[model samples]
Target: MNRMAALRQYQKVNSQAQTAVATPHRLVQMLMEAGLDRIAQAKGAIGRKDVAAKGVLIGKTIEIVGGLREGLDMEKQADALARVDNLYVYMMKRLAEANIKTDPRILDEVSGLLTTVKEGWDAIGDQQPA
Candidate 1:
């Protein structure tokens, strides 16, 4: 196989190994990190006027955010969590708008919001009992 393809296969195997041993909390962290990375990549695509890459990246980000929302236990929802659900919905909408408009600024807005959520989530993880 070519070098780039070989590298991708190695990365895929490594990621699968990590996922197999990951705690639920760590999985969520990974999802958020993936979303952030995709948003950054989408922004770069926009700068390059790479419409196809931008669409694909933003779509992946939307899927990641949806996964995060689904992971929430809305059946046992606290008020704060309900608001988080709403924020996720809002983020998805903005992401769609960003894709349609090819706007990097919208990606920036969504990235900031996701970062805020991630920071809070990380703080909660830090406070977890050992």
Candidate 2:
């Protein structure tokens, strides 16, 4: 097989393995990491003038963050959820702005915000609901 195809196969298998073994908390952490990874890659793509990759990576990052926001339970703690939801929306807007203006600084801003959120989530223990 070609190098690209082999790499894709490897990634697919690796993802499947991770999914099979990951707990809910682990999955959340994984998702957070993936989002950060995509944004970092998008920043690199921007630097390299690879417009298509930049767009794809930024879009994927937005989707991941949006999924995280959508999974929030509004009834669990309305005030806190609303705050976090707003932050997610803000992050999405920043992501779009980064894409539109081709600004790596905007990507950095969103990455930092995501890292902060991920750190808080990481601090949560077994009490977090699945």
Candidate 3:
């Protein structure tokens, strides 16, 4: 093959790799992995009904959600992003309440909420621009 043809093929391969790397599915997968780690830490606290540890986990989750929200473009998917943001805020509130009450039930509630959020995110098309 000529030099020009080889260059074109290389470019094509590089572009495809970039596209595969930048999909929304990958973003969701990253978030789910981080969330599972946080949830595992929180689970121990929940079992003991330890308010302080619960608060720490809640703070970490909030940080995760905040980071996600900052990267999200609400204009592109206004309704969906808004709903996700609202859920994140609600989760923060519930976490606070759980900490104050030392309640394990709230941990279960947050787990369910996070699961739903993850599922919803996964269902969306992975059309993020490369």
Ranking by lDDT: 1, 2, 3
lDDT of each: 0.80, 0.78, 0.61
lDDT of 3 by residue, 22-108 (tens): 444554445554655666677788788776776787667655555555555667778977887787778778767766776667867
lDDT of 3 at 13: 24
User: Per-residue lDDT tens digits of candidate 2, residues 6-57?
Assistant: 2232243234335445555566666678889889999999989999999998
What lDDT is reached at residue 6 by model 3?
Answer: 25
All predictions: root-mean-square deviation over Cα?
7.6, 7.9, 11.4
Better of 1 and 3 by TM-score: 1
lDDT (10s digit) by residue, model 1, range 49-77: 99999999898888878778877776674
Better of 2 and 3 by TM-score: 2
| Each model's backbone clash number | 0, 0, 0
C-alpha lDDT of residue 128 in model 3: 43
Point out where model 3 deviates above 4 Å. Answer: 1-24, 49-52, 125-130
